[model samples]
Target: MATPSAIGIVVSDMKKALAFYRLLGLEIPEPAEGEDHVGITLPGGMQLMWDTEELIKSFDPDWTRPIGTRVGLGFECTSPAEVNALHAQAIAAGYESHKDPWDAFWDQRYAQLRDPDGTVVDLFAATP
Candidate 1:
């Protein structure tokens, strides 16, 4: 059997990437700021890792960044209000907004934003 253990992201700027995830409530350590590779275990024991472009190239010399929306991560907020609040917070911190919070036809208050490396991040909560 195959088990998924971790999700890894290759980022161009480790500092900015860490700050973005921190805003979403991930407790990345301060000392990881300058490292080429950083990993943090999530609440459920799943690890989230970040590696610099240079670090990835060191092992896979032929590696090239993917084009357009290679990764999408969805975060479930406690409520619709939290979804809106988080979108605003990310924008205010200089991250890019892909879509404003809206009541989606699928019954969720959904919003989207791009992380420092342009990865699509979604914030959603059930709407009453």
Candidate 2:
């Protein structure tokens, strides 16, 4: 079976991007805050990476930051209320909400938000 590895995100400002992810509970090293690239291994051994726009261009000169949410990240909260709380926390910290928490037909509490780079991040909990 082919296993998923890392997710790479190219950002214009490495500092802000690292800060945003750190706010979400990911541990980002202080020194990496100013680096051109940074990454961390998640629980399942999946790596989440961030690279400066300039770093990406070194390989793909025509690369551009894609607009809109073509790909997204999903977070599972411990409870339905936690989903709402975390969503609100993210918003309070200045991230934009894409959708407010709602009981979805799929029997889950769901919400969406745009990260610093405009990537959609989903928060959910099993509601039923």
lDDT tens digits, residue span 1-128, model 1: 11234566878888988899999999988754468978888988776878788886774477578675334466777889989998999999999997788887669888878889877677878899
Which 10-residue window in model 2 sums to the lowest lDDT?
1-10
Backbone clashes in each candidate structure, one number apiece?
A: 0, 0
lDDT of 2 at 1: 16
Local accuracy of candidate 2 as per-residue lDDT tens digits, 34-72 = 578688889988778777878756644765677753244
Best model number under lDDT: 1
TM-score of model number 1: 0.52
lDDT of each: 0.77, 0.74
Cα displacement (Å) at residue 61, model 2? 0.7
Candidate 2: residue 31 Cα off by (Å): 3.1
What TM-score quantifies how close candidate 2 is to the native fold? 0.50
